[model samples]
Target: MTSALSLDGVFLVPPEHHVPDTDRAAATQLLGCDDRTLDTLVRRGLTVRDDRFDGRDLFNLALHSGTGRTVPEQAFAFSLRWMRGTAESLLAPRTLSFTLTAACRCADVVLALPRPDRYGGAVIPAPEADVVAGTTVSATIRTEGRAVPLRSPVLRGLVEEFAALGVRWVKLPDALREDESLVTTHRVATCESASRWLARRCREAGYAARTRIGWVVGMLDLVHAWVEVTDDDGETKVVDLIFAGFAAGVPGANPLLTDPAVALRTNRLVPTGFEVGARVARHDCDAPVTVRIKPVKE
Candidate 1:
């Protein structure tokens, strides 16, 4: 009764393993098959041979049967529904860490790195450890984090709408009062707080949106947070609502969709890293993932 199944290039290992009743019920409906018929359809769906696109094709057919729309459109709608229903749950506890190797910009014999914080922003340090100009140094820090899956059209629209509302930077409060929520405060917000607030709004408005904790280097060399939304086309975009103002390519254009790298470069922040999705560890997790920065050679 065990069989392997693939979804969006990810495999459900031990395919015969039991799926929770709730999940099974959801999948049954999503696949547009009654409980009794799902087994046969799943078996048939998974039995395809070497065709690389079979999984997607099969999924599309199933969704199309249920939605009466093209697979992508249906997927878009389905992801939106999923996001709305599961938005808050995505903030479940997770671990995140960052390791940076950078050459000292000055001859102070020390390296200054922006440490990662739980809320996704950090203060620039005077300098830490021993190092010299053109010398490579490495440092790592670990902390608790929450991750949200931001892949859905409705979710993306929610982020865009929030970004269009304008963004401002707020200093972290001395202490967050009990019962005070980051959302609806709206005075000023850091990248992390802003993203979380946006996630909250998405939940309120019926979309699943997630606050992302990761590093953004290049023009803007800093550990930052942002919003992530996956669209129906299976593409994900990072929405830095805090920097929404910089996205003014055309007058009044929504900048949430602007590329972080491009936005940082335009702001003269000079991002050294453009990718997100750092390894998320559990509480106090300290597994070292190597990252090295080298000085330019003459």
Candidate 2:
């Protein structure tokens, strides 16, 4: 007969209810388990007092287990759940929506938000540097960006995968690509920048990517800043990031000057006029010629 509940790796729904029977059978097949496993789970107290574990949780856990490390996507999802609220409230619906948001956007980000805030470098507005000549132009654009250093592990893995694939990018797409941020269509936030090139690399590897664009502080009076992506179109685009300024302060001293060697490492926009006041590479620098103005690739 059907088991009362499933847990300890084998729980679906109550046997008496035929309505959930079809679902039970499917779960049993996917979980690769039988009634005996359910009994054992009940004895071990992993069972539900009222009934079986929620079907969705079972599916997510199984999918998570199966992923192993082929992707850190599962782990990232789980962490988002914990970051929302108390452990019990984790199951609450509104919180779940927050957890399942398609992607992070400049607007969706909340400043001084609680745990699970992975938006790039989190600069808490240094009181001293706060007043760097405010202007009418929107600094709001920069505020939404999560500061990410080029050294995070997840980004490193993606870059390596891209290099291995040997991507050959052609031209930018005629239409604006979809965004992972909201439910509706969106153009690439940083589309005009290097995102087009980065997306090509990831696509070649059978992975997905997006580019977040903006102008670098003190760099160009106006230029796009973008970070590469590999998350499945709608998950968090920027993970494991650092404040652009702190990244520059490390022992290497002036990180912006040294170009990244890898095909996929993320980096901050170079400061304004560092190389442009005059030619500044000291002979081992990897950056190509720094043009006075960014060139239009035709």
Candidate 3:
């Protein structure tokens, strides 16, 4: 029964027959499941309306139930659904409110707050925080980002170039030797390595680029790294090969590679800078600092 479903969890219903509510038989057929499996899915929290089902709900159920595919395969599928808008719930929120807290045991810490102008988001009453030893500092920030159309003409060429580079980078074999310098190696599998590689490539091609460590607000909010490229016209844009590579299932093709606006839609950037204050003892500030982020529900 599971074999009937797509590995990436996308099941497209023909437009002519698309409807909010589908009959039991049609729902089972669309989900590539038998009647018994459909019933089991409903019991597992799949919503049904008057003996009918929504395609999206079915898709989510299949996705969460584990498609028996590898992690990379699942990530690619989720990326496709996100780009294709089949998974609206997974899309980036227009307005997001979050709380950031940092704690250290030894020395005073300085942390950078998100700036509205820098992030291309609106943050009213800007975020502020003060960190002192043995105390936890916290701040709440609300940010908003406008959506950009994926088919914009101005970014078509740039987006295509980024997509091509991303595909090539992902296909490279893992490096056997561990080299710290970005110039000495090409093997990159993680976000940091990939961003560094892309930044070097961009600079070699005559574009100003740098690797940045920051937070990526998405379906899962976490700290991440990506590249920033500045064009000749003084416009800076984000070229996140790792994020775009998630949807680059086909060689030389990734529809998600567009303007920072489109990239921001799924992976919004929140740049973070850290400064360590005076230390009381030689190992007073040796303890690792921790950061916790929580999304505020409105």
lDDT per residue as tens, model 1, 235-285? 444456655533332233332224232211111111222222332221222
TM-score, cand. 1: 0.33
- Which residue ranges in model 2 land beyond 4 Å of their true spot? 1-194, 232-235, 239-251, 254-298
lDDT of 2 by residue, 1-298 (tens): 1222333332222333213212445545544556665446546653243454444334433432433321222433442232223322312212100010112223322111111113332222222331122111111111222222444344556544433432221112223222222111111122232244445445665655554433332232333334445453344344212222122223333332222322222222321121111122222323232212122222
Worst window of 10 by summed lDDT in candidate 3? 274-283
Cα RMSD (angstroms) for every candidate in the order listed: 19.5, 22.5, 14.2
Q: Which stretches of candidate 3 lie over 4 Å from their true place?
A: 1-93, 124-137, 144-186, 218-221, 249-254, 257-267, 273-298
Name model 1 segments beyond 4 Å from true.
Answer: 1-153, 174-183, 203-208, 218-221, 249-298
TM-score, candidate number 2: 0.24
Summarize candidate 3's per-residue lDDT along 44-156 as a digit string, tens digits: 55556678766544544344333434333365455345454422333344455544444344454444454433555545455443222234434555444333443333343
lDDT, each prediction: 0.38, 0.31, 0.47
lDDT of 1 at 194: 67
Estimated TM-score for each candidate: 0.33, 0.24, 0.49
Q: Report lDDT (Cα) of residue 291, candidate 3.
A: 44
lDDT of 1: 0.38
Q: Model 3's lDDT to the true fold? A: 0.47
lDDT of 1 at 90: 28
Candidate 1 vs candidate 2: which has greater lDDT? 1
